[model samples]
Target: MTPAETRTAGTTPAYAKGRQRREEIVTAAASVYADAGYHGASLRAIAKRVGISHATLIYYFPDREALLAAVLERRDEEDDARGFPREPVGIGGVRHLLALAAHNARHPGIVELYVRLAAEAITPEHPAHDYFTRHYRDARDYMHSAFSAMAEGGHLREGVDPRTAAVSFIALMDGLQVQWLTNPDAVDLVSPLRFFLQQVLTTSLDQALSRQS
Candidate 1:
């Protein structure tokens, strides 16, 4: 049996309750962090917003760092649940990324939290430092492989290297996020990604972006 299946089968009523409460706390923390930024938000404020005692909140998260991790983890869970692919293929991988951009547009709060956490995680002593480091490495590897497949399939434009395209794409997405967060009216998130794909790929960009996943 799969680990997820095993966990589901083994989960008790008390464990389920605890898990739900943890999710609630994480959601509350995400909201607090989004509104005030991570450093500006406090565990006490998060617990108060969740209507839970500070001690009880600590019993679940133990510390602010632990709760922050849970908040990021929960967002990833939500992305997966919302149809973000785990193992991405070439064109489909790009398409999935476009879908993700669309998804991020609707969840500005989560994107803001992610960007803020990412910037803060640059410090070696930060709780999420290792997480961001590993995340970028894994993401780069996956995107490089996907673009390589595109090249192999003859979908990628000439004079473009898969690794270069992958890295550039990641950079563009991150940079665009900050710009869009700064000025949503001036900077678009999804359209720029679609245009990037259009520049790299030989196929129809309109159909690609227009297709609803």
Candidate 2:
């Protein structure tokens, strides 16, 4: 059986309790890391937030890096559960991203964590560097496929390159997040993204219609 299946099959009461405790620790750690950032967040602080001692916290995650990794993994899992693109395919994928931005508007903490960690993870030695690297690679690939599908459907403009468009779209989303985080009152997130999508897709559709006319 697969490792996942094996784990499922072998789960006992003890295993279940351990998983529960681990999830509690991760949830608490996420908040601490979000508030303090990875560099500023301490194991003792997280432990305090979780109402556990440092030694108990260490029992679940042997090191700070391991705890950070678990927090990131948990975030990804939660995002996926919230419909954050298991795969990229069509206009729905673009819509999903916009929806995510709207959802993020309500959760400044999560947004702060993502923006801060993503910027910090640019360093090669950072614990989350590899995570961010794989994240961007996968996100770009999915978006590229989505754009390619749009092109295939005759919804893309004649001169638009799917690969370039995909990259630009991701960059725009990240840039907007940074701007919005910096000044929420001054910068609107979802509106600009919606405007961009309308401009890009509607222009493409118009071009396609013009060709047929």
- What lDDT tens digits, residue by residue, belong to model 1 across residues 128-182? 8888897788668778877998789777889989999999988898999999999
User: How accurate locally, in lDDT, is each candidate?
Assistant: 0.81, 0.79
- Model 2: per-residue Cα lDDT over 1-213, one tens digit each: 544554644322136677888888888888887787899888899889878899998887878998898888888888789766576677767766777888889998898888889888999999999999999988888788878887788777678888998898888888988898889898887877666655567355334323421
> Which residues of candidate 2, in runs, are more than 4 Å off?
1-15, 203-213
TM-scores of all predicted structures:
0.85, 0.85
* Least accurate 10 contiguous residues by lDDT in model 1: 5-14
TM-score for model 2?
0.85
Relative to the true structure, candidate 1 reaches a TM of: 0.85
The backbone clash count of each candidate, in order, is 0, 0
Worst 10 residues of 2 by lDDT: 204-213
Clashes of 2: 0
CA RMSD for every model?
A: 4.3, 4.9
